[model samples]
Target: MAQDNSKSELKLTKYNNILHTKIYRIEINDYQIVELIALKNGEYDGYLINCIWKINKNQNRTKSITQKIKIQNLTVKKLMAELENGKFETIPDCQDLKGCIEGLDGTTISFYVYKENISRNYSYWEPESDYYYKDKIIPEILQIREILKSINHEFDLRTSFAEFRDNLPKGKYTYGMVIIEKK
Candidate 1:
């Protein structure tokens, strides 16, 4: 009988834990730049900004990812602030948080948190919308997914290191994947 080589244990490093993942220090200034680019040419006009951020493996890596999110008829500032402050732990209903604002740094802002009971009437533009995960979260997952995929490896998206921040209706700092996995 052949031995169960697949069951053999591989050496794990201390950095494998979530606590070991690296976090970069970013400020409002860093976000101002991205907000400018995303808004240039009126690319995201009607869509209200939602979340922005990134993920990482540990503190030793350099380079990280950035994200920008916008949703139709959704709260801009409150949603952005909630996500920034780690509110909801997961994405909340579009109607649950509602308010209105002029803009952030010249960008228009609005509010529209969802009501869980109301239920959406339209089909999802993106299949993943069913999940609480945000678009900003997807790309970061893809970065790791692509890397692991290329190497014929598999990883758990849930376990992946991710961090995000946003400035709704305009300006936001939605990246920082540096420190989890390296390029």
Candidate 2:
């Protein structure tokens, strides 16, 4: 099956007291793997996270599969509280954060703020460690992973790269990407 690469606008019609909005878009095109939409919506009532992954590396196109998972109100309040505390802000010195991890590879991670209409993206090699990643990335990743586990979506993270990739499951063969957008 063919994948749709077009962009679509997000509509918010459910909750009126939208505390903030976050959109995470991860894309790794090394082996024709694209995960373009990972949206996390945090409102006064609850939270909603929608993630989609597409893998098309097989020679036989019919063997490819697209995985879509929706997580609703499962520890979203904790995530929202973290965001409210400014845990996603970029650190002043990238080198300091790098010390926490070793042997960085060629992966890309992005953080977009919908309310401010600003985005900050960097590759694995660019920063020593990301402020947002250090502060709340792990918890955020674990939150989703735990939820995924409960629903029988299991994947392993053997290396640092794998750990990072597993945090955001949207990619194909050699490369993986994860986007975190907060308003």
Candidate 3:
């Protein structure tokens, strides 16, 4: 009988053991704002700001309201698969990642990965041009963006700094990914 080597030839990573994940969108105008949170368990929650009243012809008041939605199991599974295929487990430790480029601003994307006692947070600015950004980060980000698009949960990439500055009280916008160990 021939000895089987197929199992040994395959390389498995920690992502295989992932039970849950969460993605957060952090935006900063004058302060920090967590605009959205998406979990691997299909729970998606966030806050949306809407104009509540007009203070003047050129001014308006806005209110932040909480919103909750769920991703279909199939879409969640697809997202997980995309992450796995993106080699998320192979990503270097946060400390080892090359610092992001300056002047790259928009929404701050953050990924929180959790397994048991081990939790890691990977945050990045949009349109990073660093070496690691081109080689590793971009691929993962692209995967995430594709998944989000497929699920109709696309990130707000149209917001500009001027808009953020003009509507400081309305809060900034951002989006990203997270993974956590399932209970």
Candidate 4:
């Protein structure tokens, strides 16, 4: 199985011992990453990670820091409802991804649904605007983003990362991955 949250080591989940469907979205660019994972039982995990390396003045090395917060069951029902409301199953593949050029800067949004017998993942390579405010799967994905962002906002995620993305130094960064690395 491919690592959903792009890291070499596995990050243990609260319900890793149980059976449950996992629904998630990762909104990321060069500067920062915002991700949210929701379970059917209302367990949600979120992260606000900075892609730019931190100074780490004392250690003499730069590092990435992930600010994680766990929110219980408040928004999962609403999020799952949005996905059920003719959104996830009906949403078509993205056109931009098929003809996307590599090496150009743009925000990539990926959504996933995983379970014992179900595995679905969709991604888009946008032209980089609006933080997906006007996404094709609006009302569905837009609301999803809102809920995810709200969870991430608890960790201080920004309304926009475009403002100072270039002002920081790049480091170990992975899009759509739940980073647990501290080195």
Best by TM-score: 4
lDDT of 3 by residue, 91-143 (tens): 44333545533333444444445445555655444533344366555454554
Worst lDDT 10-window in candidate 3: 1-10
Query: Which candidate leads the pack in lDDT?
Result: 4
Instruction: Return the candidate ranking by TM-score, descending.
Output: 4, 3, 2, 1
Using TM-score as the measure, name the better of candidate 1 and candidate 4.
4
Off by over 4 Å in 3: 1-63, 93-95, 102-104, 128-183
Candidate 1 lDDT over 27-133, as tens digits, reads: 22122111111122222212211223233233322322333333332232322333334322233322342321112232211111222232121111122232334
The lDDT of each candidate is: 0.23, 0.32, 0.36, 0.44
What TM-score, over all chains together, does every model reach?
0.16, 0.35, 0.40, 0.50
Q: Which runs in model 1 stand beyond 4 Å of their true positions?
A: 1-64, 77-178
In candidate 2, where is summed lDDT lowest over 10 consecutive residues?
29-38
Q: Which stretches of candidate 2 lie above 4 Å from their native place?
A: 1-64, 83-86, 92-106, 123-183
Q: What's the lDDT for residue 102 in model 2? A: 26
Clash pairs, candidate 3, are: 19-182, 20-180, 21-178, 21-179, 21-180, 22-178, 22-179, 23-177, 23-178
- Candidate 4: lDDT over CA atoms? 0.44
Candidate 2 lDDT for residue 115: 35
Cα RMSDs of all predictions?
Answer: 21.1, 11.3, 16.0, 7.8
Angstrom error at residue 114, model 3: 1.3
